[model samples]
Target chain A: MAPPEVHHLFHHPIADHSFSADRGTLAVARENNVELYGKTGGKFQLKDELRGHDKTVTGVDIAPNSGKIVTCSQDRNAYVWEPSPQGWKPTLVLLRINRAATCVRWAPSETKFAVGSGARLIPVCYFEEEDNWWVSKHLKKPIRSTITTVAWHPNSVLLAAGSTDGHARVFSSFIKGVDARPEPSPWGERLPFNTVCGEYLNNTAGWVHSVAFSPSGDALAFAAHDSTVTVVYPSAADQPPKAVLSISTQVLPFMSLIWSSESEIIAAGYDCEAYRLQGSEQGWQLAGSLEAAKGRPGLQDQREESALNMFRQMDLKGKSSDDTKLKTVHQNTISTIRSYEESGGVVKKLSTTGVDGRAVIWTL
Target chain B: MAAVNWRTINIDALDPDSPANFDLTSLAPAVAPVSTADVQSLAGHIRQLLRGGDSEGALRGALENPPYGADERGKDVHLATIIEILQSIRQSEMSPILSRIYQSDGGTEALDVLMKYVYKGMGHSSSATATKQITPQATGFSQVHGRGGSEGGGQAMSVLLSWHEKLVEIAGPGCIVRTMSDRRVV
Candidate 1:
């Protein structure tokens, strides 16, 4: 396979990243602000910065259809940014939670979004037409610990939340007027606010770091700190799931994951590289890493690769010449991965942001 | 309780066709009693590596294998072992070793891995708990004048502070704060 495209942004931890529908603009959560990058030529150039947040911003996402951007931070706040002639206009969202907002995602419909918080709740927010304000309804029934991450189903009403509590829960976020009645599926028929359709925990009870729904919305997969990914297939609301398959790996815990297709999942984290896991209801397994290390490279005998160069590398970095650069593009743990482009329900391109502050896009 | 009762997706019973169930007990270290023989040997190995001036090697040993095994339990074992190694060594012995590691290329990643172990070590009891029980011992360890008083390990955060100082000493001031962002620590 060909190597992925790597973009070295500023050196800092990227908590999360999102790409616009047209794949032209990118939003990344860096420290307390969200920086917007516009694609210029074959590279991404920083075009704008949305700077309203006071604390470290944890999550940022762009609505594909409406072209709106939502960002949440540890400062217990969320904002929705709309593109205007004067750059991007920010509108604060009233997420009534006392703790830090851990993650946020714009729903598939673009009319709503979900914010997972350390307050042990998921607030499903949508605009209030009468009030001209963004109001959130709390999904606060059974979440016992911090909601670490969340993903909306293809239908938008079925929301999947992964929490530090070790639970990957499917909740119905159907609003009366904001959303039309969603078609019944394996999740449930008469869906209402906070209706948890299914909840699954890993065998090790590890914190759920990332969760994703298959394009068909028939399956739910979550990666936990245990270095395992468990896929759950729902049979019905009342029946036991058709199957719950958990695949454990020897690698470090995965911080983020995305479903590329019905049976293919790509995840990465402390390992500093991504891996592909393919499976069905019958079983799942780690196929291998997306970043496979090439053979031991031939030595570069150029002047820069000489003994003096070795000393220069060591004098600057304190290591031998060869060991200074990592084999992978990302120098540190990757925190987030998203589907940058998809067609006919299959993800065609993938993007990841890491603690080393590099954003990379990959083609499947 | 009834409203959320629909979530019964925990797979206690296994399907014969699926892969073997993950051995959660193996990864259950932090909560596991401290008397495990594995913890002692691992601690000794790390100390040996550090004292031998192989800080990067020692850190790699901890990072790659992580005697607790790689999970929550491994996280705890890692935290305890790091503290034990730090507390046992003399400041004179540790500074140069850490300096060498920080000067290395992947030093930033090493610091990050240690920071992760620190975060997991000073963690909430089993994410299911209502409130985070900041385990006092894990949060900050008292400097035990254990070994002819080489140097006080001070506390957990202090160990980090000392590492920061040594990196600054070896390289410069900008070397540390930029490399290790301890925003989550505060």
Candidate 2:
């Protein structure tokens, strides 16, 4: 396989990242601003910066078909950026949340979106043609803690959120006008807003870091701070899930996860690499990393025969050692991973951003 | 064993009152200094042990380090490395190891040292400048500022604070949470 494209943007942590439909535009949440980069030649060049949030910008997402960008920040605000003749114009979202907005994602329909927040609510936002702005209805009945991550089903009605309370919940975001009647699925029919379709906690009761719906939306997967990834398959609306499989790992906690296909998933986090888990209703297991780190070169050729380098290292670093670089491509913890390229309903590539400030794109 | 004896002989000289009784032929300096590099290498070894699922080994390495809680260790040196090692403790395995440490002799002291380093690291990473928040008299709930107990979902500061609560859990009411009640300065 070809080597992953590594973009060392800056020496600051990346909270979240998103790519446009054509894969030409990329949006990254860096500190208090959202930076937009355009793919030019083989590199992503700076295109623009969307600066409004006073606090740290936590999440950014671009709708595939609509090309609209939605960003949320710890400043307790969410903004929808539209591409216009001049530039990307910002439209305020009436999230009405008091705490920091932690993560945001556009529904598959692109008619609405979901914003998870520290306020312990998921704001299901949609455009109101009459009001000429986006208005949000809060999903606040059962969630008891900060919502860390949210995922939307392919049908655009089901919203899955992982939270600090160690619960991964599926709520229906069915708006009366914005959404058509979603077909009956394993979750439920006649889905209403804030309907708790399913709620499954991680086996270890860890703070759920991320959640994802299967490509078919029949199953759900969540990664937790306990270094465990769980997949749940709902049987029916009120019945127990057909299967609840959890695979705890020996690695660090995974911060984010994505479905590569119906049976495979990609999770990345403190481990600093993307790992794939594969299974079905019977069971699930970690397949392995997408790309095993080719450790830093120049190990065997250290025959310079100089005590100077070692002494310099000892004097400067205070250690009598020589290994200088990390074994992974991303030097620090990975905070976010998004599906980059897809082929025939399966993910072909993935883009991961880390606290080390590098965005690496890996081919499957 | 001779080198260890020599180091002990030197440390025995560290007692300022007995300096004149030192053997002139034994030119060993007082206190075998572990360079910043040596401490870091030990931390790296502990990190590998944790990653390899050798929880007992990693715990022993961290909790058994004789020089870890020494006052001479600066912020840029061993303390930061210890904090890094603590951050790598997977939450799934955290309870058992923490309980084991609590059950061991001087476990409270070891945990207090670990907690202090975590807070110090958090203070460095966060812009809030709340390093002084965790003192012997400070109440634990006051740090939340109305947001009730919840672990940091991902942020560094929150992660540090979250571990404090975890430390309190396995170690119980008489553990790190009682820092203000009993200021056992590690």
Candidate 3:
């Protein structure tokens, strides 16, 4: 995980966030809107507010290519909003799943996407468009359970979702029709196949708060409320369950998990400090400690006073006043994370929604 | 003579077998061949077998009968009775009698019976008397028996209409059906 070097504080706690695939633009989720930030002058500057969600926005994702943005909200709907030449406009509201989506991810090809929600009745949904209209598939099970997060396998439509019960399920759908006509049920019949990816066992333990699959589909990373982050490799059968690394960080109800560079590094955000894994070790070794937004030494005393005033008033939803009290200590809560692909694992950006009511972007 | 539990039996006895037992072989004459024109008689005969009222005579009649027709409606009734008896055969003390009907009839009757009432029981038609007028026919009977004994004719369509058609083409329609697709000798 990259060290928190530049802590950009937001006014509200960040419900969720995403760094553009090219590292050019960043999007943050808030109560009913998303804020776009531009990376400049060693910090993030608010570019624009993209608003359309009727309720609290829980998750936001940027397409790998077209810069199209898709956001999910507690209102039980996911919408695709594009930054058009005229201005930001809602492109299409993807079919609604029956529950609030905890997380969403775009396929590497950016053609279709998966949405995971809290309702087990329809745990996951896939979206695609044929002819000129958009359509979706609601894949439900005879039995029900809640799904918390979803991640698409790199370069493939394979989807992996983390459930509240601490199980991770993999789903694959095949669409035979090409670009010519509408393909029937892009999310095909659910295959009767899944594996017990991980378990939350101590006391009440914790379910998987976040899940991520490696770029090559060989490895998996899960951050759970069990105060531990588990890394697994599902490619090897016949081998016993392997936990590459475990962390003792106490992630409350919701945690964020992400993969860095080559998937060899795993990054996670908890209530307090965010951590990253650097090797194939059993226990996660802390790479860097998060620091707060500080007034630069080069600035004049008056400027520093003004900067401190801004930082003081800045309240990211997940962090407390004490956590934000000092200019040298990064707030304890982290809502989201993004790894800059081109930057050689140097600055991992941390997006934290603080108690100050802002979406803060930090480079760690 | 001994009480047999049907649920515990191996998958083989779940259907009929060719090697007849003494008890079932003796009642073959009473068993009637399900026909093509009407399934009411065949269903009645199956009713008698289930009642144990005159199963020996019923089995004897079944052996002497020819085969049933493939009219969808009539097959439905015959299938219902076959499935009901097939499932309860072990408990009836008429296992031998039921087994004989299943075997000589080629699993078709047994399968239809299983499909109709046993495997997926009927829930739609609540009134039993509503189905009384249905006549049983032996439309695809020859196709079932033709597999083992070497009968030559066009293959008849099995219950699984689509899959059976493909199988007949693959198995040589002439040696399979005993009748052409139009019911005329080819």
Q: What is the C-alpha local distance difference test score of candidate 3?
A: 0.50
Mind giving the per-residue lDDT tens digits that candidate 1 earns over A279-330? 8999998898886555212122323567787888799888855565566778
The window of 10 residues in a row where model 2 chain B has the poorest summed lDDT is B177-186
Candidate 2 local lDDT, A243-268, one digit each (tens): 99887554667889999999898998
The TM-score obtained by model 2 is: 0.66
Lowest summed lDDT over 10 consecutive residues: which window, candidate 1 chain B?
B177-186
Winner on lDDT between 1 and 2 is 2
For the second chain, the TM-scores of the candidates in order are 0.41, 0.53, 0.29
Q: Please tell me which predicted candidate would have the highest lDDT against the true structure.
A: 2
Q: Which residue pairs in candidate 1 have backbone atoms (N, alpha carbon, C) closer than 3 angstroms, thus clashing?
A: A199-B7, A317-B103, B29-B73
Superior by lDDT: candidate 1 or candidate 3: 1
Give the Cα error of residue A35 in candidate 3, in Å.
2.3
**Model 2 chain A — which ten-residue stretch has the worst lDDT?**
A293-302
lDDT per residue for candidate 3 within A1-364, as digits (tens), equals 3333444555567777777876667788878988888878767778988887788888888987888888887887777877778778775555555567766767666766666665552323334444443455554431134677777665344566666554555555333342122122222323222322233222112456777776556566676654455666543333444454444332232366666644344444544444555545344443543442344221213333355555665644433223324332234465565554435533445454443343444554
Each prediction's TM-score versus the true structure = 0.66, 0.66, 0.51
User: What's model 1's TM-score?
Assistant: 0.66
Best by DockQ: 1
Ranking by TM-score: 2, 1, 3
